[model samples]
Target: MIPNLDVDLLKTFLAIADTGNFTRAAEEVHKTQSAVSMQMKRLEELVGRPLFTRDGRQSRFTADGERLIEYARRIVNLNDEAVAAFTKPELTGTLRFGTPDDYADRFLPEILARFSRTHPLVTVNVDCAMSPVLYERSRHGELDLALVTACSEIIADEIVRTENLVWVTSQRHSAHMLDTLPVALSHTGCEWRALAVGALERQGRKYRIAYSSPNSNAVNAAVLAGLAVGAIPEICLRPGMRLLSEKDGFPKLSQFRIGIVHRPGRRSSAAEALSRHISESISNMPRQLMAAE
Candidate 1:
């Protein structure tokens, strides 16, 4: 036996099956009730079967309709899956994601957690390093996507999130000591380090690196010990640390424009979902992040 059926008819049938009411199914499909009734009649005539038993405006699928609903769901899902696999972009291989040091702690878990929930089958490989290092790697295709600093070069096709840079010193330290270099920072390639150093250079203020480490926690620890003034995200400053504001001639660390970057091509559903989650999470950062100084 041959069945002549259109995809739209099947979609209508599915909607009717789920909603269990002609009026509701018509609304679900954005069709007028009369139009839906006509289509259902046409579909039933073509299949030589009464798909639903109707009592006034209410309807219930017949035994054959129950069997057909399962097949319809499979057929529709498979058709969509096939189109996505071939016509759309297929992204099933291992996805390498790069991220800077502190963001891994601050953001990756939420991003990856949602990503894994959505795409449980895809493998996510995270490469965490300093920002400049990851940016270079992403440029070379070593990583498919990265959380990177948004300098002019990478601004296009980037997802930008703004954060302020503040000087954090141990609460025990006197505010006057800020004149001296109080904290060490990451090595030469770090974005925060560049901002901090550049601001000092512009101010013509002489300062020394009290302690330098690639690890942000290490820098925080140094500041906690009153070894030096560490520049940190206003969000990340520990409770015991004092964030110096403009009254202190605030060494003017520029704001960080951070975002995700990828190669110039279509992204996988998994990657797109991850990127969206990251954008949402960062944009809607907790009030703690922008708390008043």
Candidate 2:
């Protein structure tokens, strides 16, 4: 008889995968570190394959472990869905959700679709703006929940994802090769703009802000049109954009974080449900960014 995999074990396994550390996974799952290890061992035995291999002090997923992530997420999600459907009251309410324009373009569609399917009666009103604007709205209680890029100036309730910030230019253009680089970026006070300009300054590369806008779509359009080079999170990269690297005389930029913040006090069922969907959807995204060849 085939052994049935335990949902509890799978949850613990997913925590480890999401956190990438046994200690952190234990904290997430509310289990002792040793207990988390034993749970992983049991899971491996059930599957009859080693799930993780140690690299120095860190534990990395093996090929089978990587492959099982999708199956585990689906299984756990379905289990939760069944339990929620039977045990909980149907959620119904209007939720005010805010996010930066760039994040909305890349992540909102999947998050909203999955959430609507689970809570059909919940209405999500999306507001797209700059991160600072969203942060202010969330703090003012005007938005129920906001997803923003984490920056030093604002404190986020929870960080859901992190990725490299890369320089991009049009595939057909030589904008990066220009003597005085032309940059397309968000308006003043944007963290991405600051980072990009600072990096260029440190490299002693002369650059001018050729295009500036609060809208990510406009910035991307300038880059795609080969009018200027722009910096964006790896996940936000478009199909026609080419990455610039140190070899291209571009300095490396640091990783940026995506975080979610909720209004203070009690959260409505709709807000709670959407928050869970956002966290799960983002945490399950591919962690590795595409490298410049």
Candidate 3:
């Protein structure tokens, strides 16, 4: 008899794959780490193959685990789509929404797909830009709601998610060995840029900006090509990049607070519903998917 794989278990498997560790995966699924480990054991038994190997604290995926990810992503998306279509609530009207590029690329598609299924009559006008711009625009009533990357100084209406900041480099790169650490960073005004540079300066570490771009892809490319090292929201770090620790001479960085800011005052029923939907989707997102990759 062929054992039927549970969708929930598959979901958990993908979560582990995404975060590169069982503990982070457990947090995403609202399960204890021990429970996650137990689930993995059960899953491995079902597959009848070893699926993970220890890479320090990281759970490096075995060949089977890697293959399962492609299948898992498809299965989960299809399952979610079916569920959304059947359980949809009737909603209508247009919604003006804004999000930073990072969030937009990572989770918005699935969120919007579900929203479209649940509220077919509602039109969502989405603006994709930097967090600061989105937050400012929403504050001035230009957008009904916005997702912003909240720095310590920027107060937000509500925080929907959080991410640790970490240094990452290409697997083959050793830019940290240079006398002047080469950094791939965002533009001058980006909060992340300011934070990374500040941290380095405070530690008296000399670094040169080897590359700078507003587009995260360009920044990541710089790191991927072994030209430089960069800081990213740990949740968004993709596969192929190795995370560096303080032991590797990288300093600890502040956590990123993902905040939801909505226009002040009463909002339309559609807006309210969509806001709730967006918030839920974001808050429930697994750390791995937050990386646009």
Candidate 4:
């Protein structure tokens, strides 16, 4: 029997719709790009209409795709609600969680909102800081849970995702075109800063640290203001920020890893549950947030 256009298909459709890229949508569902494409083909077959069309590499919704979005969202929401409604215990307790501020601002609300729907009574006290600091605090028991942007060298069983680092500049600024490139980045100990500077030096590219901030907003602000080129994850590049490539004379940077850290040994059920939810929720980020036009 043909599966009844189930919740999984709806979720996949939504991910593709939201991300506009097959690879990204696959990331959301922890599937391979080929699998996502195959599923999309199956969905189109089931609906008996073309749902998407590609313009170059970017996927745009066809009329039929647009029509399905509303229904898909409603069905997915109802499906989730039904599942949560039956889950026992109402999952209550405080989980002391920590994440970097920039990531929190971009991704936390949706994560927490959905988590709350399933575990309505759970209280999540979130601390926003540098990812390294979050890990340190988690190690010392200052936080029950932490999501860290761990440098690739630091392996952890809890690693959830790995993303590439990209060189970027403000679309309004030609800073990267200069003889000595100006850079805006986090203060010392930032993995991006270290990897970026190292890449430049290895390539014999001259650069100066024109702006430094412990806060991500400040670094992005400086870059946005055309003060300097910036190094950040590709997922953080939105319009107004130009992603640099070999054509732009910038060398590639290393990957950044995201992982969960929790207190060693025994942990509260609430904290464990919250940590799992957070890991799953990490990919629920808004599309076009870092996507360049």
Candidate 5:
């Protein structure tokens, strides 16, 4: 007989995948580290495949482990949806939600769609702007919840994900080969812009800001048009774009953090429900992006 996958074990597995460490995953799932290890052992026994391989102190997912992530997420989400449908009261109200344009493009569709299916009466008012602007709006209580990129100027209530920032150029263009690199970036005060310029300067590579915009789409447009190289999170990478590496004389850029911040004081049921959906949606994002690549 085929063994049934355990929802509790899958939740633990997802916590490990999301945190990238068993110790941290244990903390996340509110279990002892030893118990987490035992759970994984049982999981591997059930699947009859090794899920993780250790590299010194680090734990990396085996191929089968990576493949299981998508399935696990779907199962867990469906389980939650079923439970909420019967156990929780339906939420209704308008929710003021804010996020940067890039995140809105990449994540909001799935998040909002899933949310609406569960809480059809909750209307979400979305505001797209730079992260800094969103942070301020959330702080002022003008927004019920905001997803903001972490930077020196703002604090996030919870960091949902983190990924490497990469330098990219149009696949058909030689923009990265230019002596004075033409670059497209976000406007002043943007953390990505600062990181990009700082990386170039640290490498003693001369570059000029050929395009600057507050909107991510504008920067992406310049990049896709082959007008300039752009620095963006790996998840934001689009087709027809090639990454510039150290071999291309580009310095490695730091990882950026994505976080959720809430307005101070009591939040509406709609806001709380939406926030849970956002977190779960983002938790599965990196695995989906990796699978696509």
Candidate 6:
């Protein structure tokens, strides 16, 4: 007979793989680094394959690890759906979740991994798009829950997370040129782009879109090259990047609301479970940022 695999252990493995850093992964799962390492050791022993390749300094997913993550996501999601459907929870159908593209690179993966832990049986379909598109989809029933950023006027049924908006620039650039140069932003429908543009207009400053990319990484690349100044989450601006202060002539942008909107009315158990996990994940890493300089 095949040995039984522990679902909780699998969840921990997935977190480690997603973050690629033991410390960060540990924080997500509420475990100590040493405790997480031990869990991985046990999981590898039980699976009978090496899941990760740890070079002296970095950890990488093995081919097996990659395959396992795919299966793990499905397993975790499906399990949650089962608990919701048959048991006291009762949420079996697929959960189509949407989020703004800005979160795609930074937070989505981690959030998904955490959500999967509870709803191991539900299928989670994720859509990353502009806030308007996501909101429209949720309204149309195409999405069960959506995490988006929007102006105060676009109120939602639920507000999930809120974050500080700050100006980001390359450390190599001087502060005086902030308002003079063009800025990098996303396509027009994006909430962040709108906020950035609104702030500039309110200050009576003249600027242009020096560059715009559909992908956040592309925009980050433009700013990294000293191409232009852009507004980004305060959490995302790390030690190696420059934050424009009041002295720099760039006014502090107001905090943006990152809300989680779900279909109005009562929610199914599976949906609630997924939402709870996401909230937990977000809460755990309240202001965690990347140092990708």
lDDT of each: 0.73, 0.89, 0.82, 0.81, 0.90, 0.74
lDDT of 2 by residue, 105-153 (tens): 8788889887877788888899999999999999999999999988898
Model 1, 127-176: lDDT tens digits are 88877677778777787778877776555256657888888777897632
Scored against the true structure, residue 98 in model 6 reaches a CA lDDT of 87
* Candidate no. 5 TM-score: 0.85
Model 4: per-residue Cα lDDT over 227-270, one tens digit each: 89999877667668888898989998888887888876688877
RMSD of each: 14.5, 3.4, 7.3, 6.8, 3.4, 10.3
Overall local distance difference test of candidate 3: 0.82
Write one digit per residue (lDDT tens) for candidate 5, span 1-293: 99999999999999998888999999999999999999999999999999999899888999999998888988999898878877888988899999998888889888998898888888999999899999999999999999999977989998888878999999998999999999999999898999999989998998999999998989999999999999998888888889989998899999889999999999788888888899889966654464214
**Model 1 pairs in collision:** 182-228, 182-229, 183-228, 183-229, 184-211
Better of 3 and 4 by lDDT: 3
- Candidate 3 vs candidate 6: the TM-score winner is 3
Per-residue lDDT value at 187 in model 1: 82
Model 3, residue 92: C-alpha shift (Å): 2.1
Q: List candidate 5 segments past 4 Å from native.
A: 1-4, 15-62, 287-293
* TM-scores, each model vs. reference: 0.63, 0.84, 0.69, 0.75, 0.85, 0.63
Least well predicted 10-residue stretch by lDDT in candidate 4: 283-292
Question: What is the overall TM-score of model 1 with all chains considered together?
Answer: 0.63
Report the alpha-carbon TM-score of model 4 versus the true structure. Answer: 0.75
* lDDT tens digits by residue: candidate 6, 1-293: 67777888888987886777788999999999999989988988888999889788888888987777766765765666466445653345788888766676667787777555545568888888778888888877778888777566556775666788888888886533854757988887767787889988988888889888767777777787788887888756644468877887787788887667787667777677777766645544535333234
Q: List model 3 lDDT by residue over 120-232, tens digit each.
A: 88899999878777878887889999878887656788888877888999988788788999999988877888889989999999999999987888898889999999998
Steric collisions counted per model: 5, 0, 1, 1, 0, 20
